[model samples]
Target: MKYDTIIIGAGMSGLAAGVRLAYYEKKVCILERHTTIGGLNSFYRLRDRNYDVGLHAVTNYAAPGTRTGPMAKLLKQLRLRWDDFDLSPQVCSSVVFPGHKIEFANNHGEFIEAVCAEFPQQADGFRKLVKHIEEFDELDLSQEAVSGRKVLGEFLSDRLLIDMLFCPLMFYGSAIPNDMDFSQFVIMYKSIFVQGFARPFAGVRQILRTLTRHYKQLGGELKLRQGVQEILTKNGKAVGVRLDDGTEIEADNVLSSAGIVETHRLCGTSLPTPEPAYGELSFNEVIFVLDRQPQDIGHNETIVFYNNTEDFIYAPPEAPIDTRSGIICSPNNFKYVDSQQLEEGFIRITALANPQYWMSIPDEEYYPAKQHWCDQMAAAAVEHIPDFRPHIVDTDIFTPRTIKKYTGHLNGAVYGAPHKILDGTTGVENLFICGTDQGFLGIVGSMLSGITIANNHLLR
Candidate 1:
């Protein structure tokens, strides 16, 4: 196929690039290895139930300004709207540590007040911290050098407060709170708390469907099951790509959302080898989706239970969220459910796994062990919600291997690269990287990274 731009990988980054290029009337072709669209945003089905394999919810979707947020603006630019979908308003995220529980609210003032209510001694420090985050202005997703740890450390002295506040956000960013750049942290905080957070009523896959529809509507050609084996470059320029089936497609420029390692492999001798970063091999959780919802679990937005910070901080240098001893739950709340299906309840329990540990397991033993891990996780969740075990009519578990096979990401990394404040920009010509790997995970950071890459390479 001959085109103006050839985009590799159908993930959000690749899709965003294709959408932008196509909207500008550029003949764009997106080649994806998967049979379906939405790389990490894709889902899997077990029986009649659908489970999200990658992304769950997004922040800043409910923000007041429609075209200001990254995803919202992209939809508008593509003449797409997600108004039809049912969206749940997440005003607070409840954090639980043994006997202690704190609710992080959406409103900045209210959030501070809530925190102060728990730890009154740290009230002044929390206020100053919020002030700093609110005052921060130079929020640029493009600039590679920004540390979140340094920014948070300035105002937060209590170690408990740091663990409570920065830990969850770090998981969302897929970067260590201490290592993250100040600017990125500011942008992330604004997107979540200042803007708003929301989840699609149907699930994450529905959002992907919406994006796919928009891409097709813009005259963008999508080639599914067409894996680009190599980037056919000649005379120091990206000419096109060679598919796995020996089919060669020519194009002016090749944009890869297949991740750093896969993109390098496809590029062959065209691009230099990308150096490994702290965030590349990070561990993500195996989300167990239960068929039945608990009856006693009271109304709560999202519950994060932390046993201790030791397992979280000392586990791996790059592990964003300590799932070994922690758990994040999306409980069954009447406010979040549709009126028709109120009886058919559902909930999600996520437990973080050690990537290295999973990697060490023998190939033949991997799948069975993964199932065992899911069982253990389900058991652990039952500890929190007693009625959870009986309500489970069906369950689905996804490991890093499943993520790697589906998305072509390195080590099944939930996000992409670790966002480092110091070495954010690696000198690669005509080649750019983004997504979780470039720092900033979750919906907001991923979309922001897409905007950064577009503004830097395309708009420039």
Candidate 2:
């Protein structure tokens, strides 16, 4: 039977979109190339320990019954409850630069107070910037691109404070190098500083499982390990898809979370615009299992975005990994309800990586390279937080190569194309894009991208 929609990539957006369509009583099938779901945020086991692929924290946090913000909107649209996500708000996180540091929690007031206290001279300007963000409609799809850096300059005169504010937001969501669209800046600002960070006790696995289960219950067909090799198009319309094994299925519409450049290649259809340039930035994720909780080692921050110098260079590094700056996170540091905790102590550090260098490294030297950089990464991190190196027992490293292999992202661009297709429209009549390239970010934003695309384009 012909399906009402065939969604590609069982990542957050694809699964969410499938659920949205199926809930409307449409016939939907979600196909994944990987053996499991959660393309970029899946989980795995190593030496009897669990590891999450891309989750640092679920941004845009909200309480159990809030009726506003992205968190509440997501649950309301998906017909889910807050307990479904099981998010615990972060304890506190900080952005540390040499001779300067500011801390913030879920409370936006604390962040404002910290900024004002830290940069007394820029307090008034900073408040004005906050007002600008509050008034901006970041979710407007038809908005033209505007440089965040330039817009920030119009509000504040302090370069350090501007870079500091941009640090965490860019690290978590920016696809562009050393810059972002103004709308993206507002969205990231509100999500991280205004709404804040949180995580489920079970990491990414819990969220993925929740989405998959809901989709299935709504009569959405999910086929894992069923990779789509190509888009079957007819007269500028998406007819269906051809599986990697050469099986063909027909559908009335197709939605892809596989990213813009990748999807363009798959479509093989004549389009109105040239294929967009994919992003260059990627990361080296270093996970260290410690012998004790991070708090025991005197490190209590949930996540620390540290830059060794004041410049905060945001680009692909010339070296294997950029040790000058990185993020250090301890999952055990979140304010979990009932004082519950994970079974193991974990410290994660993420550094900007040279994607070309990591992807082209000799296989024989890859493992050794990971170890060598892991040491450097930790060395840089210890300067910001207490040295927990002595407590480390096991380490896991994943680079751009691993990302490309799993998600099929061009250059393993974690945030997909630098330019976002906000309207989810491709040149093909019924084929659209979602996920990273669709412009929303993180777990909440990615899921919201799918839902928005489905509601605006598919359902209507």
Candidate 3:
């Protein structure tokens, strides 16, 4: 059957587009390769516990104005409300240095005040740095503020502030501070600072479920397990798609949320080969799903404990288990809690891994490699929090191959493309793109990209 719009890749962007189109009473079909929706917003279950594959949290939901933020307005328009969960009010992500740790807050004034209270000697420096960040926030991305890295260098002259403020934030972008454009960085920073970052009540899966429900409610058709092999084009415009099973679905227009390279491949002769910048891939992540919650962790706060910059240790290196950069969050306290209490509780820990290190292994050996990394990460977590090991009830690991097999993302990059200058542009006519690669990495970026793409294409 012919449809007004056929969206490829049911990630957040695709879903957002479907929602908008359906709202307009346009006939739309959302074709997803996977059996489920949400793409990186997807989740998996190990026994009774569920782990979010991606989408840790999002910011900018609380901002006023209907069109201020994409997710907020979308939810409101869909008649959905943010499910209240036990979340921490601490806007500041806790950063642990060798001898000291810093807790960042949401309010700019309060955050600056806290920093000054913690390190009085650095007050002046910190205040100046905050002002610089505020100024950076005001820069327009649509204009000359094209490069993130250059703008950061110009704003932050102090070495300590650069390391303390920019390093952790850069981790979220998955790139160095200077490598990102000023406008992109400001969008990310504002999402966290102004919008307020918070996790869902059930998990990220809840958000996906809500989006899917809304999509269906709008009379959109979703076909799962139907891998699209190529775009069926007549002349120079996209007309439809050919599925892996040799079936064809026709449409007036196509929107892709698949990774850049895959989208280009699907377009076939309809669109030119996307330049190299559009197809660059990154490493995959290794995630561990714990059976029993670890002890000596917070149920209210998200703890990112790093022993040596690479890993967050709950135990020593020689211990039976160790983790590199353990991220712990409790399903209980969805809101803020006392740091002392959060330092000691039942929790889950995830170790961030370097994908390149596992490249030498054979495809069949990927699972074992993931297991080895999980064990090491678990051991490390036990060192920092001794009671961590005895509680392990279940574990599952994901490799690069696993990511490619499931989502068709180049390397299991949770965020598809690097947020760089050249990567954001799409050279195709009446064709647009969004997702992690198009410069929007996290939930906020994904949602914002939906609005950005729509504004560029439909609205304009």
Candidate 4:
């Protein structure tokens, strides 16, 4: 069998690519290893409860009829209606240090005011920084790469304020957290702060469903529970793919949403052995099923970017899990529907962890390590959210190994292959790469990545 285009991985990027091509009436097929779609943004069921795995909160929000920002562009490009995503603005979120705390309101003015009030000495610098970010052209890859830390330093003298400003943005997007690229930092600031954060009424699965429905409506083929074993190439051009089941299917083009190294491996001898230079970061996430509403527990903040230590470190730690710096989100606080429809509210906590350490642990030590980290994180949460422990009705934990198994990301790299600008090329004609490895992060960014590759490579 042959297709006009064969897209590997049915993640956000692949799905968006499918929607774009199918919208153009191309015969496209999206292949996935998993039984379901959404990749890192996918969800799972736990007995009677349904938990969204990847999304703590959907960022980059744009209001209806406004049709601006990344989310607006995504919806407009995909021919999706504004009603497709029922988004509610976060009541409040914050970045907290030992002595200072900055609240982020959904409104741009309020957030700016909070920042200015907190750092009155650097208020002028902050305004100029935001102006620069607003004016920065995110698509201009020709712009040289500079360190995010360095850029912040140039504007603000306070290092902690820099870390505070970066806490949420970096966690959401940056792979090299300590020293993120200025381009990335600019894009993220615009996306998160300028555009703001909102929660989807039906959660992430709803967003996936919306994309899937649109693709199928456009007559695209979606193949789940099946994956490509190899890229069938001839004369240094990708002509087709062989399924894991030994079936050979041909295509004029192969667009891979798989990370760069993974896509390179599919190209046979054209590429060298995979040496992922971009240091990958993995995380340990635990979800707590709370018996009461977040507000009732004295946790009114919608999302909190926090750290126990005075300093911040973004890289994967080689030592035992610190649980020092991480994000805490209360889903119920932002749930769009009536609080009564939900039987219980939930709180999620995440911390950076060394994927290598988890991989090297003995089989006997696996559960022990997981338990140790789970307890450590729970204890750490009390420092930020005082009511974290008492409301816990049930708990679920996911480690690096779980991420690797579920997403097939190398070493459980959550954002995948770091931030290098690749031209979606593999020295193999008619083959391209997108998604995380393509330098776009977050749900909106990843979808845009697919649309980008489809428009630039497939359509052109």
Candidate 5:
């Protein structure tokens, strides 16, 4: 097969790339090893129930009539209407510590009010922080690097509040937990805080469907279950790709969303340089299918970012996750359905997990270890989430191994490689990188990365 561009992986980035190239009337082909789409942001069904995997909510929602943020531009470029996405704004989310709790409303003013209420002394500093973020441009790499801790320290003297502010941002966005770069911290803060979050009425599946339908309508070719074995290159430039079954498909250029390290491995020849550290962070996630509504069990919040410790450490613990620092998301709350109106509720809890630790466990001890952690996480969750123990009708657990198997990430690293910024260039001419590796954090960011590369690098 021959095409103008061949994109590997049918994730959001790959799909978005295909859509843009195809919209310009170019021949684009998207190949996926898995039968479904969305990569990490995909869904599955078990016993006639749908379970969403990759989203707590689509962060950084761009409301209708305002083509402002990244999400807005993406929809406008794709010719998709805002009505296509059924979105519900979150009621509120809280960051809780030992003696203090800060709840944030969807409105920016309300959120700022809540923050200022806790630390009135830093109120002026908080306004300055916003002004700085608004004026700062993360795309400008000429500026010196700044750490998130340093930025927070400049504004607030209270150490606990700094940790509290970063707890959710680190979990939701940061790959470098100990100290996330200030640029990344700024970008995440803009996306999550400035733009705010909203749940799609139909969940992630609807977003995938919209992208796939648009791509197909624009004459893009989508090949599922077709794995690319090698990226064919000659004279240090990408030419095409070879499928797992040895079928070679030629393209003018190749775009890979399989991640930087993973894509490098697909090159048959040994590059004359050392590869950067690939897999950095991974997560241990649990999905709980409750028998009753979330509000019925007294867990009324849509999402809560809670921690047991006064100081937050983003990395995985040496032992089990007993610290009780994690995100609790109630998917049902997105629709604003009351306890009496809702049927069942879905809650997903995520924790930073050591991929190496899980990989070293012997085959005989794997399931036992998983059971122990599951029990511990559930027990710890009850302290924050009401009726967590008794209301669990069913449960599903996914380890780093499972993530590796599905996503082809070396360590099941949630965010591909550390310090992977935009430009999508991977030192190999004509082969560009996108998705998490391109430095955009959430779902909207990934799609924007795809569009950025397609227009800036490819179409240019």
Candidate 6:
């Protein structure tokens, strides 16, 4: 069947694009391989308990009634309301290194003050860096690839501070090892430190359901269990897609959230030179379901980014899980309205993992390995936060293999490719890429990625 656009994958980028396109009365269909939507940020139930797959914190949080920022603009573009996301701002979060700790909330000024208070010698440089960041146009699609670390070095003299700053940004968004694309760095910095983190009281389902319902009301077609096998092309132009069942659907244009290298390979072609490297940055998400809130144990921070060693290492670890550095998120700590609270407490820890080991692990050994690492990772995490093992009633863990199974990313790279196609262009005339490899980051950025690509390329 011929149509206007067939968007592959039902993740944030794909769904948001579907909603935007459908809102304009374009014939649009979203094909999701998974039975449900949300992609990496999906939700599931096990033993009668709900769990979020990829959500740690929804960064770039803007309070309700706010007229600007990514959050507000996302709502505006999709024709959604401010309360649709039900975002509760983070109470506070911290970055803990060897001898220094910097705490920040939604206030950019407070974060700046904390940084200056901790690093008295580098205060001038830090302020200058902030000023430069404010002046820099990180949204320019034509901006050349520059090193975030090198740029930080130009302003800040301390390597430790640089690494600390890179820790949270890299863990949450960086695709490249130990460094980030400068634009990406700015985008993430602004989203996290500037705008800060927040979450829906109902978890990822809140945002996913809102997007899904909105898209359907706009007459968007959502087809689940329809896995795309290939992109049907003619004379180097993408016409549509072939489903796994060999059902071919035609469209005037094709948009993909399948990642850069993976998307090109589906076309039976290679990306023209400077061949994009497959991302190796994947992590093991170990979630502990506790009997009580983390605050009961005196661990009240919204999130903690900790590094045991002097220098922060952001690369794929040689070990099964790198507990030396990781992210600890207590979903129970957000400042929800009406004193809303989750039924159960959750301590979700994400640590860099060796993709090769996890992806190649024997099916028989998977659960055992997960259990062993879960125990070990929690041990490392207790050093920076209150020990919650006594309170954990149940535990769940997923690795890079799970990421690949769910998202189809090579090496289960959470952020897709090391290189980004900022403009979403491909060699094929009507084929484009969005989501992770397109370079906008986090939930807010990812949703905006879909809207930007659709507005720029498809809906014209």
Name the best candidate (by lDDT). Answer: 2
Ranking by lDDT: 2, 6, 4, 5, 1, 3
Which ranges of candidate 3 are over 4 A from the true structure? 61-71, 74-79, 83-92, 117-122, 135-141, 144-149, 175-178, 278-300, 305-333, 336-360, 382-387, 419-425
Q: Which ten residues in a row have the lowest lDDT in candidate 2?
A: 267-276
Per-residue error at 148 for model 2, in Å?
0.2
Pairs with steric clashes in candidate 6 = none
Candidate 6 lDDT score at position 111: 97
TM-score of each: 0.87, 0.99, 0.81, 0.96, 0.95, 0.98
Please identify model 1 stretches exceeding 4 Å from their true place.
63-72, 82-86, 141-147, 176-178, 272-274, 278-291, 295-299, 309-311, 314-324, 331-343, 419-429
- How many clashes does each candidate structure show, in the order listed? 10, 0, 47, 0, 0, 0
Q: Write the per-residue lDDT of candidate 1 for residues 1-460, one digit (tens) a residue.
A: 5787787777766776677777777798989999987787777677766666655456665543455655576556545555733456653566665555676645666766878988888888778888877776645544656456555667767667666665555555544424456666666666665664566666676666766777788898999999989888777677788899999999876667666656666666555545455333445455544455544444255555454444245234333223445455562442364433334455555555566666566888877876676666666655555545555566566666677778877767675555432222333344455565555456555555555565567545
lDDT score for residue 320 of model 1: 26
Error of 6 at 317 (Å): 0.8
TM-score of 5: 0.95
Please say which candidate is ahead in TM-score: 1 or 6: 6
For each candidate, what is the lDDT?
0.62, 0.93, 0.57, 0.83, 0.80, 0.91
Candidate 2 TM-score versus the reference:
0.99
Number of clashing residue pairs, candidate 1: 10
Candidate 2 lDDT tens digits, 10-73: 9999999998998999999999999899988889999999999988899999888998999999
Task: Sum up the clashes in candidate 6.
Answer: 0
Worst 10 residues of 4 by lDDT: 334-343
Error (Å) of candidate 2 at residue 101 is 0.8
How does candidate 4 score on lDDT?
Answer: 0.83
On the 0 to 100 scale, the lDDT of residue 379 in model 2 is 91
Q: Write the per-residue lDDT of candidate 4 for residues 1-460, one digit (tens) a residue.
A: 7799999998899999999999999999999999889998898889688888888877787777785678878888999888887777776888888788988756778788998998899899988888877777878746777888887888889888898888888788887757678888877877777777777866788889999999999999999978888999887788989988998999999999878877777676755445456446888999999888777778787888887677888888876565878888877777365543345778899888888888778989998889889989888877888756776788998888888887788778888876564466666778888898888888888999999889989998
Per-candidate Cα RMSD to the true structure, in Å, reads 3.5, 0.8, 5.3, 1.7, 2.0, 1.1
Q: Alpha-carbon error at 214 in model 5, in Å?
A: 0.8
Error of 3 at 101 (Å): 1.2
Q: Can you write out model 3's per-residue Cα lDDT over 174-205, one digit (the tens) per residue?
A: 43212455666666666664455566555666
